[model samples]
Target: MKKWVLAFIAAMTFSIAAHAAIEVYEFDTLQQEEQFKELGHTLRCPKCQNNTIADSNAELAQDLRHKVYEMTKEGKSKNEIVEYMIDRYGNFVTYNPPFTLATSILWLGPLAVVVLGFGLIVVRSRKNKQVATEEKWDPEKEQRLKALLDEKNDGDKQ
Candidate 1:
């Protein structure tokens, strides 16, 4: 039947469309595999936001993955490879940056924000707790209110 043929075709199409990604290399090369893993985690995907190239599915990620495979196979020192990438692409291409006087503010910015937020909340809560609610009514007005309420109650009874 046409229904059965269409169903089979649809299932095949869906399966084919799924990304069949897998690890490109076996674990037998212990030194190379470990280094690649570390390098992969360090390298940023040029086309993906904040994700390492190895963890991204972008075209640039694939190219970087190939680059890692080739570079590691050629026995380049890990530091040398990182320095090369940093030199070619600048610091933004990698997640980690060196610690210096200029970067001290960048590193401490989140902690400063949290401390400021907590201080603001404490100050606001103190302000809220300081609300004045007690009121002093004039003695003459209180007496007038009592007289009016008593008269209303007497009228309702009558």
Candidate 2:
């Protein structure tokens, strides 16, 4: 019983010490800290599709977090840090990227899809209407068809 208790205490102590290895940087001011948190939330982890740098535990996310901290400490403004991230990782790193020729596709793609979908729907509806109109009753044609069928039936009976 004594040995088991000692082993449990040792394990707990080691676990606590191990968790202390994750170092969090301190900011000089609350405003700086808030800015850091805001930037982290805004910037995406390069390798993560949906996770912000603040929420991701990926190696790339860790690196980016460290870079943001270092830039903040060096008195870099939020826009400067954001520009640096965008420059390094392309437009994917930031949610609000500046308009550029390369990013035009992202802005215009949905509109193009919607217009194409409407055009296809219009064409299909027109085609269906034409087919429906073609099948409308024609008295003369129907009378001719009825006579032909009657003649065939009479020949069969004969």
Candidate 3:
């Protein structure tokens, strides 16, 4: 395993030094390279956050890069390409997924939690306010306790 890893690293070093091959396709032009790069950076790796598929050195990103390159060469509309990738990989492919009933919860869940937390605080505050207002002691019970204390005091004085 160590030997294989070393060999892979050596190959990667060699590849890194090698230039990126610009495939000369009749349909694809160099003009579309900037557009492709922009689209690539917008896409997310399903496994990672903040790391664009273009920036990630993962094998999955390479496959996706190939797909994006082909789609761009084919002159498919940007929307169509984005839709295709989303269909293939789900909403996980996008840095931000579209808002719909299914996705609405994902987008709003945190806000909903904050609102609920606020509500709980308000309810707890009202309860606390009410707690100090109510008289808990029965007057009869108070009088009985006071009489017992006076009787004990009288015995102690004797």
TM agreement with the true structure for every prediction: 0.58, 0.75, 0.68
On TM-score, the candidate that comes out on top is 2
**lDDT, residue 135, candidate 2:** 91
lDDT of 2: 0.90
Most lDDT-accurate candidate: 2
Which stretches in model 2 have alpha-carbon errors above 4 Å?
1-21, 134-136, 140-158
Report the lDDT tens digits of candidate 3 across residue range 51-114: 7888877778777877888988888767887899899989879988999888989999999999
Q: Give Cα distance to truth, residue 102, candidate 2, Å.
A: 1.1
Provide the clashing-pair count of each candidate structure.
0, 0, 0
lDDT of 1 by residue, 12-94 (tens): 99998785767576544789889989989988876786999778988878887787777888888788778877777666667
Residue pairs clashing, model 2: none
Model 2 Cα lDDT, one tens digit per residue, 74-123: 88999999999988999999977778999889999999999999999999
Report the alpha-carbon TM-score of model 2 versus the true structure.
0.75
Task: Give the higher-TM-score candidate: 2 or 3.
Answer: 2
lDDT of 2 at 14: 92
